[model samples]
Target: MGVHGTVAAGFEGVREEFSAFLTDEEHAPGAQLVVHQGGERVVDLWSEGVGGESLLGVFSSTKGAAYLVTALLVQDGFLDLDRTVASYWPDFAAEGKGGVTLRELLAHRAGVIGLDAGFTAEELADDRAIAARLAGQRPFWQPGRFFGYHAFVIGALVGEVVFRATGRTLQECYEERIRAPYGLDLWLGLPQSQEPRFLSTLPMLPTPEQAAEIEAAAASPYSLGGIAFNEHAPGNGELYDFPNSRAVRAGGQASAGGLGSARGLAGMYAAAAFGLNGRAPLLKPDTAAEFARIHSEGTDLVGGMPKAFGLGFQSYGAHFPVLGAGAFGHSGASGSLALADPRQGFAYAYTRRRYAFPGGAAPENTRLLGAVVRALT
Candidate 1:
């Protein structure tokens, strides 16, 4: 299987790393990678089982898009970071959450990770439904005392705030202000016309040893990790199946329901940090820095792992040493990762059709990103 697409002259090493990655995999994990240096797309590549135009379920990498929209609204003064969330959506004030500020909510500190009564499949597919139920739920921890990864519901939570303030859904704002203007291939609410390009996400094919490790590390459905992912729900399907549903892609639940190609993901971030075409960057340096600054760092209460966050985006510098200090982005459960490194003057996106073993950002990103950084230097 040959790698497809072009790399600028000096970036051939990235293509070599990508091909090596495909060769090392036991199964062909249809993958796409894109990188932009300043305003120019320096790398655009895809491997077997997928095309350069193919769209895959990007899972939580979708969060980066949502966070970018929120950051823009804040930069425009339509939203306030320090103001209590209850000020925008009064219902969120119920159950001792009145004092939870927008900043705290974005940092995963409000503690209402999920409902004690888990969400139905339909509710999980709709951001409005998820927000409505969570509005009255009690926090899992004292609000502002601790932070947890609101894995499945943060997008809906932030979307609710966007709706209350602007009388528009975050998806709507994204399409109108970001996607359409930039002509980006990424879609919050994927339309019928673009359906043909989407490929269903495949489950992870782990080796026997890897399977045993996953089984051993599995937590109870009622555990914090389980609840955060809505695994406690009676009829809940696997996480990878979330974006496989047409309804999920159509609704664009905001948290993990995004569908896009690597080009779309990379382009969006590039437009945000370095501008695209002839336009000015979407975020001012001050606004971008504020949202990208580390707001939370340490063991996450829900996942019980060392995690870092800046507003809603994952602060990637700690996880990827090659990235600059304020680098920000989000990774999907299917091993997709996308972000813009303002300090490094580049935006990178990698998407996979099959879930990577050990999940999160995918181990291959470390080597692949290293190759990209070296080429840039």
Candidate 2:
């Protein structure tokens, strides 16, 4: 159960248990977890075929990074959450979405969840193409009424606003402002050079009974929008493997398909908590406060579960009860999670090459995290 590397400060057992649990076959094949507290790194650990320099697809956890980018734009007076999205991108008004505000979009309430028209993975790489499709798409529900968990669309919309404000894609803005300045290893649009370091995603394991239930649920109107009965049902899984998925990757959709190391992910959150390792703050104190404040708190339309969403990051109570409101962050499809408690300047980040079984978090993962929290308290 001994972690190979070092634990920064204030946390020791957390790092040890994290490494041990990751070694389990059911958890991350290769993963990293980094934690910081009191302006110092307390637990920086990695194992299970992952190393200090490894990078993994962080899934929805990418939302935190996207949220940071938008927050910066707001702080600089380039974007306003209260303003209509069309004010920035006129073409967006074409689809009866002229009334949507930046806040609704960020909070996953804008309702751009599903694209009626199909897109290839390659199409996602072309920013103009992706934005055009997104802009022309209609909302699944009325804007600002409730949350539907835009899943992938949140990133595209947020990216567009960031695009309009800076005259650069979200990828470019992140590199220029956030990643490069902090030396973060995260990438919205990964370069080809790093492909070797890319860990292949692990497959999900469902027992025959579990798979049957999942299939049934997917077919149910409550799950697949009744599309499960149609021959024309969209296959979202295909979009992940195909090279054409770059369009999805390139769009910087904050909800899914972002890449980074656990260290980099935790580093960004740690900056918000501890204020950037002796550098200028990543966000003003008030801005950081806004980032953690819940924009929408209720059951999600898609997941049909209670969720607490902030400006972009998912709040703690939505899933992990151990994560207090002060501990705000996001989790990927399976086990990937990135969070920081600004109150304590404690950040925890974990990423893996493999996808987790669908249902809840890996028990070993939670058990490890629980031990960490218990130790910290």
Predicted model with the maximum TM-score = 1
- Please give each candidate's TM-score: 0.99, 0.88
Worst 10 residues of 2 by lDDT: 224-233
Judged by whole-model lDDT over C-alpha atoms, candidate 2 comes out at 0.69
Q: Report the CA-based lDDT of candidate 1 relative to the real structure.
A: 0.93
Taking the tens digit of each residue's C-alpha lDDT, what string does model 2 give over 1-377?
A: 33467864556677657766654555535667776665566777777577778767677787788888888898888999899989999988866789988988888788776566544444444545566787887776787897867665567778888888779887788888888888887777777776676665666666688689878766453252332111133553432242225444444445566778878888888776666668766778788777678889888776777788888877774466666665678887656778877664577787766666563234555765676677678
lDDT (Cα atoms) of all candidates against the true structure: 0.93, 0.69
7-117 per-residue lDDT for model 1 (tens digits): 999999999999987874543868999999988999999999999999899999999889999999999999999999999999999999999999999999999889897
RMSD of each: 0.8, 3.2
Model 1 alpha-carbon drift over 4 Å, by segment: 24-27
Q: Residue 274 of candidate 1: its Cα lDDT? A: 94
Error of 1 at 316 (Å): 0.7
